[model samples]
Target: MTLKELLSPVKALKTLSFATESLILTWKEIASLFGLNQDIYTNPLHKPLAKPVTAILIGAGHRGNIYADYAFIRPDEVKMVGIADPNAVRNGRFARKHDLPAENRFYNWEDVFKREKFADAVIIATPDNLHFEPCIKALEMGYDVLLEKPAAPTEEQCRIILETAKRTGRIVSVCHVLRYSPYFRQLKQILEAKTIGEIISVQHLEPIEYVHMTHSYVRGNWRNSKTTSPIILAKSCHDTDILRWLINEPAQHVQCFGGLSWFKAANAPEGSTERCIDGCAVEGECPFSALQIYYRDKKRLYVFDLPDDTRKWNKIILRNLKKTNYGKCVYRMDNDQPDHLTVNMQFDKNITASFSMEAFTSYEGRCTRIMGTKGDIVGNMETYTVTDFKTGRETSWSLKTDYHGGGDHRLMQDWVQAVGHQNAQILSSTIDVSVESHLMAFAAEKSRLNKTIEPVILGV
Candidate 1:
């Protein structure tokens, strides 16, 4: 039978309410029938703080701006007191948005530190290689921190930050925003309740969309492992964390396999030049054509803002295209990180999990399948389905939100609350827990390099 024909009975069964028909309710629907729907993870309706927890923003780039934007929405919860970035334009934009005065804006993080502590906390959104110093210094200066993830580029650096947080008695929350998302929160709740019996295995994939991969790993700031970090650590540490969280156990061993299979000089189209803006024969056919992505369609323009003068904007863009790596042919760039990877892991209690990251997908998001003794759950960021193994019944749910399933905003709110209350436990992605996943990513990279199974050694 065709797939649709086979699923017709299942559809009919789902439509019949338990009270009206002799139907086998799915484990998920049965849970709902038992009023599980009423129990959801709710954020605290925090009363306005008597004095808002003030913060300094370091590395006022895309990620930093995202965290700082929360102040625009809820100014009473947290305030942006100081801004620091090497880029004058970016720093000025953030300062103007928050109405930061001249004294509160600095060109470098060191200058921000030169002054005595001006804020209750710091949001360290510097690049991977730049995380260690500012985080350690901020901790020493009596500032709690919300450090952007991969915590640091190296395992040792991650440890130093964790140790500093401990010694200084400061709360250092990593931006594992997925943990704060409602979808993952509900999934954790279901697992905790044993609604799916015991988890046996998990299959997760992070599909880095083609254009996105080209924009980020291929041509953008994260193009080099030596300068930044591995693609796995840079992009998928959150995936490792989610797997560990769902399994509720420490990962014992891991094996990984991948390489720079595409997006290299060997894979470039015949007759294509090093840069796409040069009259390339395949510009129209090529999806990774920098001209198409950056100039023609204007899709990924987060790196620089388009100027109001069309003529000036075009001139600036063309100049950048000639001088910068962003305009290079994807297959001719100097990127070293793999465009595809797979990791197999064994957690404590013999639970197993597998994860994959690929750059050839049509859309961006994560897809996951969790199998338990009695039921299985399958989901993406937007929706999920639960099936009871015995009855073949299914229940599904859909969620709608913008940007990481509302995780970015949720994480900021939680950090504000945690910092305001001086309570570290209120934060979801604490440094201690987040560091484990970073270690796993490191181990995974080791496994990929040596072609051997590696043990995950958590430092803190």
Candidate 2:
């Protein structure tokens, strides 16, 4: 497809134009021609109404890989116009894998936005602190954005990004990929039906609380708060967003307390080296082995996969464990962001929710208890358990999600659909929806420091 045609889904299809009426039949025929009938022709949602888009990916680090996979293969709706990351080596590899033309590959996001003149969209998957600059600039440059979560490091930064999004009239979607999950969507609808009868309060416990946090924030590059934002913002933004979604409450005041308790310098074994492989011992005994485990080959990758999964990380690690150091020694790295954290949020619904985030737990998953005046609902999202207090009955269901709660595929398809019809999902609306969760995260730091509750709204 031509570059301009690649920007708009409705205009990109070579065969089907607006005047054409037999789209389903045309799709079936086209799908049969490529032997992709099963993959493409089955759903009205899957077919591209127009031309596919060409997206420029920024910060091809860990999360960048996920955004790239969805943009390129899963959606089959966006061309990978290019990729830009400060680490040329890393993004360069991505370019090579995607077969992007050399000119399409860039060393910095600014160069791509400034020099290249344009792209249909930009996926800002950089570090938390580095997000605002590229996001604002790219929106102004006319590229719709799909930003990684914890939209910005601070409240002001979050506002800046949101303001620019409005002025530009371009889209900006946060990587709060959970909102797209069927599992969660069902839960939201159930709660909205007053399943528990107006949530009076909520208690959320993220065990090792979502394994990725332990992998990335607790023991990975984002381990230190100084390097990024707090552990809450860096890792638990998804969890925070969940609170907002389930409770339908804007966080008012939040109080949190956490510290680098378990994975500290004092905890390190004397014989162990700063590096993992050169350690004194415990390669087999200790579960947190970095060299023997997590990154023996490549570092941490994204959790979700597209085409029907919330995350592919579990599969990726299991498949490549011997090749990468995924579960090795934890003490060798400069770990810091709190092995545990607790946040108390008072929502506008007048419901108070307490979230407990921990990274050191042996068991990995999420557990939440929601109490209402008339009844209650207790759920273990990882295990798929739901209990109702009103009926005193329990219902159990598990989502067979391959990646991102099996929602990535649907999410990508819809994004293409949105780009096709200009009907973007409200969840990815890129303004307050993105800003609120992050502001709470930044406020959590202050609350922890002052030993008091910091208001999420601060003012409103």
Candidate 3:
């Protein structure tokens, strides 16, 4: 068996923080389900079972580097064939680090797809605004795709991408990595089976944490709601997607109330300026050094082992902060995108959801509660538990996922395996379920802007 298939229940179960008995039961269940207990074997896949699927990573920024690691998980099923980015420096550095062939690396995505049109699939890890064009083109090129989340920024784009997938007979899967988490999948299965009995309401709070808010919104590319559409699309797309997935219904209406409540120039602690190091007395006290921290961070990922030149790092980091719709000063990086926002959504079948994104928290894992006719379920992502309503018990099943960048690897693996199936419905046929989640975000934004409850729409 492959290392993944043969993973001991004890080992996998250990990642979660469930009560001892619950942990053991979960492990036993997984083992029994796969019959791993009966068919105990060693190194069934000393070699990878699937041949490497050649792929071109369309975005060479942060996420582009991540998808490259799929080759590490199942090297036989994937290979890094190329990278595409508009910036020559980022493109070159990413190509060198991931060992993408020099000839395969292209500065523009269209150049690769138009002139060569190579690879079994393309991974569109590009920025939110750029997703639709490449996705439509990738499908047209007859290549299956792994498109990153907030699939597209607008409802129109979402519809277009989904429509093309339907027309072209190609695969398009979004990076809803949380769905593949063994922890969540188990919880969801139990909930759907009515271990939670007719889930009626879902309460979800995404503790974006001040640090994460700063990383993606303040200092990174996602700070601008105008550019990326609030913390909802930029960061909480996963959380929103999780809510939609948990309930398994179309959210018919949405109303949210919140704003850039923290991290603003007006709220800047007494005497703090626009810059972190320049004329700021608190630079020494702050852990999130705007200059030194992100300075090293920017290059370490994008330029590691490639160049001695520090200029590119400076340029990217400075550009990101200057354009920060989130904030500029380290003490005031809480710009826009609502420090705390609450959403109320009603599903078509009368199911209800309450979703919140908060900037201030103990910086822990996500907390989820699903209430149904039969029972209520609650779990912390860090603790990994799902309380049983029937017995008033919560079991431990803390999930194991890439803590740093989310679970892109497993998501990619599932997408590949699904696509490999000959009669795959979603792998190469449909993408509406994923696309609709993004449309919900767009509707949420419209609600936020227009100050009215917006009706959600999903296209087939």
Candidate 4:
């Protein structure tokens, strides 16, 4: 087939299961036929897109804004042409930042599609529950999608998204951004080369720092499991996807055990009030006090839509605390998310993996250890060391971390190229592969709730 025909979605999906080596070879051979340099097709940066790939932002929140920032950083690679957000403050800020025309600024996500396909892709960074609708709608409307993680709140919805992407032949790139990070990419390379011998077992940890747990899971948008999703899927699906990617195999079974260990009403300190701003006796002492986290320290103040006036910062925060969930006592909130959880998974070929998500840590970074027959590897997010069993020699590497270990912007780079070129193979985290991690997460949650070993089933 010609290069153009081979890059089509229907043809690309047929080779989705091909190893990266085989895929690259095929791409190289095909490029030679067209008198194209191999690197031009394989490395997106080597060949620029004919024009910047334009996108419409569906949810101009934290992630949406983060991804859209790439447009400003590299205007020649990608551009933001439209935005849709219900919150006036957020929508207006995003519209102004992107210099979007009045007609392109939408109050509802549905309105963006009401007119016509205006952009090459649509970024769905809406809430966990809002993912499926926008993603399906965008794909059906002939716009590629950059979907935020957790794919959806449930397995059925995730499967539907996967099926729709396959049938519609649209590229649905899930934000498993870590796969694009230098740290994890190097780790995967080591595993792929058998530098550690045959894979035996893996251990991974995600330290969801104490303050972050309180802000996001206990008092913020994802506070309730039903309203959002289980902590495993909401916070640690990235870990699951990383494990699956490193193993290069699907998980066959999963079992986990954990629950609300603390941060419940029963754990409330003596003399604590329902809200931290209510002069609770423990406000000064409590680490989870909204006053301490938001007002005094200004840690997660980004979640609040405070006015631009510098002098009003203190007043705005105080007023926000009094009315919003951010001001509530962590111990008294209706949060059911587990503060700590552990998971054991069995992958194909007798490979085993264990994962832990801890919310009580003072630090936030992934810690990982991989053991094989001939060697082992261990590392924190910044640096990793590998030991050869035969040579008794150790090799270590260190990398700098940016947003999501520098995966955020890198992902945006690859995604824009993929959409601009109409090639899904450029992405490592397309829905077909990414949905496996979601399936693993669902099975883990089921095992946690049912107190039984659960098989990792992929379809609805």
Question: Which stretches of candidate 2 lie above 4 Å from their native place?
Answer: 1-48, 71-76, 86-93, 209-215, 279-284, 295-333, 385-390, 400-405, 423-429, 458-460
Q: Which candidate, 2 or 4, has the higher lDDT?
A: 4
Error of 3 at 151 (Å): 1.3
Could you tell me how far off, in angstroms, the CA of residue 50 lies in candidate 3 after the best superposition?
A: 7.1
Instruction: Judge candidate 1 against the unseen true structure and give its global Cα lDDT, from 0 to 1.
Output: 0.84
CA displacement after TM-score superposition, residue 118 of candidate 3 (Å): 1.7
Error of 1 at 113 (Å): 0.9
lDDT of 4 by residue, 34-83 (tens): 23343321353336888999999999999999999999988998999999
Per-residue CA lDDT of model 2 for 68-107, tens digit only, reads 7765565457777788887756766788878888888888
The top-ranked prediction according to TM-score is: 1
Clashing pairs in 1: none
Model 4 segments beyond 4 Å from truth?
Answer: 1-46, 307-309, 400-405
Give candidates' CA RMSD values in order.
5.3, 13.0, 6.8, 9.9
Off by over 4 Å in 1: 1-31, 37-39, 44-48, 308-316, 400-405
Return the lDDT, model 2, position 206: 81
